[model samples]
Target: MPYALYYWPTIQGRGEFVRLALEEAGVPYDDVARGPEPDGGVPAMLALIDGDSVPHPPFAPPFLRAGRLLIGQTATILLFLGDRHGLAPKTESGRLWVHQIQLTLADLVVEAHDTHHPIASSLYYEDQKPEAARRAESFRNERIPKFLGWCETVLERSGGPWLGGRRVTYADLSLFQAVEGLRFAFPKTMKRQERKSPRVVALRDAVAARPRIAAYLASERRIPFNQMGIFRHYPELDP
Candidate 1:
């Protein structure tokens, strides 16, 4: 059976990270929530989150249903995909290292989202422009460089390309997504930051050039970055 992934249909959100792993692995899977509601949609996704029949209830969207197993959280889903699809190192230590990098990337994702919604998720960006401006300033001036520089350091210390070195892992794919989101939301900041972190940029470029990833990116299935998503581009926030 094809794996069924549950996430918000309209936005990539956290689900894109899981989707990247599935796509890069060349596996057949149903983007459940994106399908018609009668079969798969937000209602179907909510069944796993709020339904009484599910043995393992996920806290939110972006969970995966693989046969009898119900997996939640982006990191956990990616970990499963990495191991199952040879996207992670074979050695335990190497796998842990990549997982660690993924968690760090997750941290960066949260910070990026907060740049626009620093006050509350329920509040609109307009409601917290003042706080967001302050938060985004710090993120642009310090956080972006710190995160990108740290990623560069990790890759440089590794044996070769990829976080685990030589072989591409799910973490590498995720790092690419993170970089892309940052570039979309903070183009000016990233243009400056990329100069200081060429390796990270190179890795992002490399991931984009992968046959499967490239194909998926060009397809309609790939959602365009919009203001509604986690990575929103506000001229004021970015400036």
Candidate 2:
């Protein structure tokens, strides 16, 4: 059976990470919320999180269903999908390294989300604007460089275009998503770091060039980064 991806409908959110990988690998997947019915979009997603179905439920959006396996956590789901779809390296060590990069990317993602909502996830950005300002400053000065530097190190150590070296993997997909998110959220910061992270940028461009990825990005299914998603484009937040 084909995999089923459960995620919020409107925003790309964490689910986009999984979507990018699937699209890149040309794997078949059904984005459940994108189906028919009222509230089948966001409300269905909310219900799954609120319901008692999976014994090991996800703490947030972007879970996957593959036969007997029900996997949550964006990184975990990607790792599984990558391996199953031949997008991952064959060696155990290589797979471990890929997972490491994915987890680090996940951390960067969380920080990016917090840049626009530093105080509480439940609260509106308007209510947390002051805190968001402070967090965004920290993100621009500290977090962005730190994360970019680590990715630079990974690229340097890997010795080329992809995170796992030579071949594209889940790590590269996640990193592409990270770069896209950061570009959406911190265009100025990304511009400054782009020169310093050539390998990272090359990988991003490579992922973007893949036929499936290129097509998906151009398609309407790909949501534009907005103020509501993890990567919010606030003019004041840039640079």
State the C-alpha lDDT per candidate. 0.92, 0.85
Worst 10 residues of 2 by lDDT: 37-46
Residue-wise lDDT of candidate 2 within 135-154, one digit each (tens)? 89999889888888899898
RMSD of each: 0.8, 1.7
**Model 1 over residues 22-67: C-alpha lDDT tens digits?**
9999998999889998788888888778888888899987899888
As a whole number from 0 to 100, the lDDT of residue 146 in candidate 1 is: 87
Best by TM-score: 1
Model 2 pairs in collision: none
RMSD of 1: 0.8
Q: Return the top candidate by lDDT.
A: 1
